[model samples]
Every structure is written in C-alpha cells, then in structure tokens.
Target: MAELEPEARDRIMDVFMARYNALHATDYDRFEDGPKGTDHDYLCVSSSGKAPLKVQHTRAWADPETEWRVPKDVERLIVHALQRRLDERKICDRHVSIRVDSFPPKRREKLALLEKIWMAVEFGLNRDWSNPSLQRLMRYERNDWTQFYQPISPYVAELEILERVPPVQAPALVGWSATGEEGDGVQDAVFRTVEALKKKEEHYRGTSADLVLVIDFEVMPYFQDELERIRAALAARSIDFREVWLVSQWLPVSADQVWPAPNVQSADAP
Candidate 1:
C-alpha cells in the first residue's frame, strides 16, 4: 500500500475512530441531542402505525391515551441526525442505508433500524480526534511516503483494532420467556407482561431497576448472566438499567411484599 501523507493519515484515522464510536455509544435515542449520562436509550415504536417516521417528537409522546404516528420524514431525519453526530467525531462519510425487515414487528422496521444506526452514530460523535493519538493507538504509520500520499500498512490494521472497544449497556432488563410444562402458555403470558413493562419503562430508563426477576415454575439458567452482560455493555456507554419481575406458580420468598395480578384479563379478550 502507498504511504499516506501526514494530513491524509490523520483524516482517515479520525474517520475510523469516529465511526467506531457512533456505532457503539450508549445513547440510542435519535431525537435526543448529545449523550445521556446513562448507558442505553429506550426505543419507542407505535404499533398503531399512526406514528410515521416524520412524526413530530412531541406527538409521539403527546398523551398516553392518544396514539402517535411516525412521520414520513423520519428516514431523512435519521440520516441527518446520524451524519451530524458522526461529523462531530471528524467522520466525513455520511453514506449509509438500512437493510430490509430489521425490526420485524415495526411497519417500517428498516427505517427504524436506519434510525437506530443514526442513534448509534450519535453515541460516538463527540470525542477527541488527533493524529498523534492515532499514531500511538495505531502503532504503525507510513514514514517513508510523501506528504500528499501516505498509506496505512496492512500489519497496522490489527493495532487499530486493539484500540476499538464495543459500546456497552449495563444491567438491562431485556425480554423474557417462560419454559416448563406450561412453556407455550407461560411464555406467551410473559411476553405480554414484558411488553407492558417495556412501555412503562420508556418513561424512565436509567433511574429504575436494572434487574428483572420472574419467580416462575421454570426460569432460564442464563437469565442472570444475560442481564449482567447487558449491564457491562451499557456501562461502556454509561447507561443504567431497571429490573422487572414476573412471578408464576410460586412467588419468591423475599418478594412477600410483591403481589400478582388478578386474572381479570383473559387471553381471548378482544
């Protein structure tokens, strides 16, 4: 590879580093400007299809009773917000697109994913980008090349990789599924419960419980580990977590204060 000039090398490194950050930052909300102190942001989707990508931010959260629409212009905003965020880190390339059906439940899941990419971009946009730092981080730079054209060596690529770290969200209460003799029915119920919790959690992401414990006939063995992983991931981005619990068959001994819901809403309810 031809050696890159000093200026060219600096510019390329800046682009690489900024892009790395935007993809992993804890802040995931596309509408929100700048990074939130906590790791991870809640993504809201309106199932009614009332909210378009271009839907106004205020309208989306207008009232609990009113259904919000995603506006048509959301794709453009996603790209714009992402690019602007990426630019802050000195990344010049704004070219990007969403793959098909990334968010399956969403009417425009692809756009949502695109918007997510922008949100990821926002996480890494505001950081220091300097050539000397790059050289130290990269460990390999073309010293023989002329000022106009200096190339990055192939071996040096590995060094650059070392400096890159995955963005993390800490102690997240992801989704849940029940397993046992009542696997199907229990799982279905848990899914609905988690979805409800997710909606409520949107109002508060970082300030609430980061752990969700469901006392059930059978709980997944990896549940706690998974939650910890989420916490580590969010910690990288400074996001917090809130925990939720679903109790089935038997409640936790310590959860004497917690109570189960009455069976008023049946599964077949229209």
Candidate 2:
C-alpha cells in the first residue's frame, strides 16, 4: 500500500528489521528518543563500527515533505540534536543511528546542498534562518551532516550518525532511497544516488571511497536500469561507492544490484 497508517508502518519496519537481523544477527529495539521533534520507528548502535546497526531503514524512500516542507524551527531542532551527538565522544565511539520508515523524497542532492550553502550564507550575513542554534549547526556540519529535515515544511527522514571510522579517515554517513516509483522510475534513483555522491564529494574532497549507498529492489523491474544509471552517476562524478548491496530480501520482492547479489548464506547455512 502507498500510504500506511503509523501502526502498520511500524509493523512493516519490524518485519524488515527481522530480515536484517536474520542475515546479520542484530539486537534491534524501538527507537523512542528521537531528535526531539521528529519521529522514528526503530534504532540500533554498535561500538565496533563493523556492520553497526544504522537507525535508518533499508527499504524504499518516502518523503514526508513532498507537499509540506519542514519548517525552519523544526529543522534547527533536528540539527541541534545531531550536532550534539556529533560532539559527544561517547555516542561517536558507541556508533549510533536513528531510523525513519517514512518521509518525503529528498530534494535533489545538488539542490538540497545548495540550499544548505544558502542557509549558511544567511547566517554568515545575518539574514533569514539566522537562529543561534543554526550557528552551532554550522559549526559541526562536517562532523555530522545529515538530511533529517528540509527547511520550510516538516517531512520525516533518516537521522543517521557519522561516527568517525578511524583516526586517519573520518566516518561518513549515507542516506538512500531505493523506492523506484518515488522518482518516476530509474531517473530518480540516478538523482538520489548522485545526490549522495555529491554530498560525499563535497565532504570528502574528491576521495570518497568510504562512502556507500545501499539500494534495494523496491521497483524490481528497473533494477538493471537503475544500477546502470547509478554507475553512470558515479562515473560522472569520478567517484565510487564502498559497496552497493541488493536489499531485496527485506523488501516486498527480491532483486540484486544488477541481478541477484549472492544470497550465499542459507537460513541454516551458518
């Protein structure tokens, strides 16, 4: 169903979490402590950083702000919370993430990023969106930049943590929307995928090998087409991903990055 009630959505998230756990053995839990104003369905974290449970889901993408954008106040609230965690030595070391099951499709990464730059300019010149908290939001933007809320209207999105990976290289967080129908089929996949690359490009400064975009088989028919578009998108930017897994088992249907990404482990294989 396109529009699911809150309860139903939570249940769907539960099912997905179960599939993820079966494959990766995770101890998932309901995420209650959201970033103050937003909502989340589940959460998880790991100190080891290897396969750390990301609070964000692995299903298709939904945009809460498709029609109503997230207001500036609410956006600041989200930013403040993320910045707080970014500075927290404990959370960073602990590996944290806040997942969302529903939300509006993300604005084009290029456009959304340009908007962030514009907001920065607003604060830089003391124009609109000049709250003091926003100033703090900018202070730690690099450490924990995310796409939780877009300014103007409120829309639910993922609140992933950028827990640093190693002393030499920093941790990079990735947000993905594998739902093909949301973006008019393969084109939007290209958009979201490239948008992700753009964020990493700007943040990582040309070298973003640590960056990854986990896509799924939400739109099964266009998997190959979407994968091709993603490849083209990466080539256009002169960047590559850490890896792209075919997250179909958790989805309604089954698919892989191009075909079936080896489901090598049997349910009882291990």
Q: Which stretches of candidate 1 lie over 4 Å from their true place?
A: 1-105, 129-132, 135-270
Over 4 Å off, model 2: 1-5, 8-12, 27-42, 45-52, 57-186, 196-270
Model 2 scores a C-alpha lDDT of: 0.36
Steric overlap count per candidate:
42, 13
Candidate 1, RMSD to the unseen true structure? 24.2
Give Cα distance to truth, residue 236, candidate 2, Å: 9.8
The prediction achieving the highest TM-score against the true structure is 2
* Tens-digit per-residue lDDT, 135-209, candidate 1: 112121233423322221211111111122232322211111111123322233333333344444465554544
Return the TM-score for each candidate structure: 0.16, 0.28
Winning model by lDDT: 2
What tens digits encode model 2's per-residue C-alpha lDDT throughout 1-270?
123356644544454445455554655544322243222223343344444343322334333232113332333434444444345432222222232222334446424543443343234233334443332222212224444234412222333222232323333222323121244333455554444344434644644344223343242323444666555455555444443333433324333332122253312111
